[model samples]
Target chain A: MTAAEERAVIDRVRRGETEAFEALVLDNQKKVYNLALKMTGNENDALDISQEVFIKAYTGLHNFRAESRFSVWLYRMTYNICVDFIRKKQRTPVSSLTYTDDDGEYMDLEIPDTRYEPAVEAEKRELREALSRGIDELPQHHREIIVMREMTGMSYEEIATTLGISEGTVKSRLSRARQNLVSLLNSYGTFSKSGRHKTGKEVEGHG
Target chain B: MADCKKYMDMISCYADGELPEQEQKLLLAHLDGCASCRALLSAYRSIAEAAEETLVQVPDGFAAGVMEKIRKLPRRRSGGWKAVRPVIISFAAAAACLALVFTVSPQRFDFGRNKAKMSARVEAPDMADTAERGTDSVLMDSAVPEAGSGEFGGTEAAKSDEESLFLYEAAGASADVETPQTGMATATDSPAPNGAATDGQPVDSTSQVTRHPGVKLGIAGVDENTLVIYYAVFTFEGALPDHVTGVEKTDRGGGLYSLVVTADVARELINEGYTNYVIGNEDAETALVYYTED
Candidate 1:
């Protein structure tokens, strides 16, 4: 949604119109959910966090200063909520803290059968799983900044505002996150010149 | 002198197409003379492109979940400006009583341990210690008949005194002034449903009691019109509280808590424009009522 449209919706929402909020939710939910999923490396937690963030935005709307755009404010709240959850999890030291599928797994998208063979489906799933692991393995700070930059397409200034850090910090963090991601994706398999991962260059045979 | 760090950092910026012409020329000149810097720039450009490609496309139905959570929140009860008529009267009555209490005998209730315990309650990792707060302070003052009495050492009074001290610590938090930066409010000194005020004096309106004993308060009253308040209460693994049902949390970092409240509340807030706030009082200790209009 355009910034003006968002502002109008937010204005309507503040006036007690329930439907107006759906625009705000519909507009940014995907980005918010994707960021959570990437950061927590789990789907269920991401969904939960995304929902919680909107609820928080609704209640804290009173504190929403006009210095920043509504989207930036919302994103800032999202980052804070995610970090708070992680902090809570850390406070309780437990043995064998395996990343549960519910912890960071994305909701399994229902892929309609295009008459693809079972083996093709399996390969696709495996690729997704590999990508998920690679993203999950990044350091917490790096993973978060990368998600903000790449998934949300937020500028460095916006990211810094959301994360309560300097623009320089945002740039540094994004650079590091990208470098880490490159190394991770490369290790999973070689990337051909076309950017797709090549399981085996010879067998794929593009000469 | 060491070479300019800004000039060096410009290589990464230039690859991003973010460098000014002068800086870009300086970087290219440096790269021409320095193979290491050239390689570094190339590596950064590649990484930037890869990062751009690495973003995972967000899946569908994410908004539905966020909206769902916002729907579950409790609505705010706006009493309008005329509503303050009774509240102001009550505040006046309470102030008069306070003056009478002070004039009769100016007894300083030194909430020594009470203050410490209150701080701990507010900052404790969990809200478990909150219950022990009010019950302990009042018991301590009355039980200790004398400051250094040995007769009550092993008696029930001693036990009650210990409990009261615990409550006192939680109640006597540092006084908060009515400042713009932090508009803090506390509960008025009315009796709880089942217990008396632990401290002999009225529990000052400086420490607000949280609703749902173990719940920690988060942002309250989205705006003047929205009725629902949000709390970072309890552990909801992979989900928010049933009321805050719809949101999906993202990683924005820092010790921040965020949630989406329902559209109705959002609209109400927008219209009201944040003109009023109703902090927790004795009967309703946890909730704060804020309004935009009269």
Candidate 2:
């Protein structure tokens, strides 16, 4: 949502127009849901966490300090809820924890855009599956930081403020998180020789 | 160098555009020339894109689910004493119930837990007051107490009050730095008994260890395994400015000492070239007193 539009919604919500919150829910639902899906690596858990996030947002709206943008705050809430879920799951590991990446191995990007081609779609599906597995394997802190940084495009200071941390810590954690993800992906053998291993190296280098 | 740690540290900030623009440009230029770096950057972008793809999709009826919960929450009556009455009544009832519980089953309340709780309650008020001062020093004298012993159990409330006294005294150190008339606990050369005064207190427990030769400052409410500290105070050549606070006094004890500063000031000091102190005893300081990054 545009800044102006978000502000308008916030103004309405602040004035007891609780219905206006639906506008927010509808607009950011996709991104929020996507974040959940990535973090949980399961559609059902993702959906559950996304709904839980919105619910949490609604109840905790009173605590929202208007110093930063609402979406930034909302994303932080979403990230935290997901983390809690992951932590709880870690304590009581479930059968789903060991689920294999069913999607095929190859990321065949060389194929041209052929209409109605099953092969290309299959490759895409496999790539997505591999990506999900790689992400799921990342340490919780690093994964969430990456999701917030890359997916939401929040600045370091903004993320820091949202997470109640120093920007230096955020930067440091983010660097570590990315480096960890690169190693995880490399270990999984998901990347082809074509600039695949180097990507992680470069990220590690820069981080 | 094949293993350049500094360059590795820049990637995360670089990805977030946190580096200076010129530094970012330089990094990008280096990436353009460095095949290994280019591949890694591309891989990072891909991974980020993949992460973006993985966001949780909220199910339908999410708003309804939330609205339902909101509806169940007890609403405050509109305006004035009518609205405030329920809160007061609930609080009174809660207090009565707690009193009855303790009276009926006095043994139910573990003395140590009760003491800790009491101290916690007392310290909260002092924390609020210190927080208002902005530069107030926070002194937390946390004791795990030996296993199967309750020496401090009955004195929890009084000791908590003492903790507040120490906090108020520590805040005084800040008073000279910023505001004046913080509290009256004059500075002294000898370290007080740990049980007597927070600053000059005498050490009663042989096990009570001194960390870094002074008190430390840090935030509470972090997991033990993942203790993350954002602040630490070390030596200074001259006396602390009248407006500055140190957690401990320097040799000669000339200036008002404040062991800890707010996280904001701590960050600034770090950026301006402060050092992280490495202490010997981990068990000596409470989790709140020591800071670390997990």
Query: Which structure among the candidates has the greatest TM-score?
Result: 2
Measured by lDDT, the strongest candidate is 2
All candidates: TM-score = 0.48, 0.50
Lowest-scoring 10 consecutive residues by lDDT in candidate 1 chain A? A198-207
How many residue pairs collide in each prediction?
Answer: 69, 37
What would the per-residue lDDT of candidate 2 be over residues B28-80, giving only the tens digit for each residue?
A: 77766555555555556556655565544566787666556544433323411
lDDT tens digits, residue span A135-172, model 1: 56766766677667655777777776555466666555
DockQ of 2: 0.21
Worst lDDT run of 10 residues, candidate 2 chain B, spans B80-89
- C-alpha RMSD over true interface residues, each candidate: 13.0, 10.5
Task: List where candidate 2 sits over 4 angstroms from the true fold.
Answer: A33-52, A82-125, A162-165, A194-207, B1-6, B77-294
Q: What is model 1's native contact fraction?
A: 0.12
Q: Quantify all predictions' global Cα lDDT against the true fold.
A: 0.41, 0.43
DockQ of each model vs. true complex = 0.11, 0.21
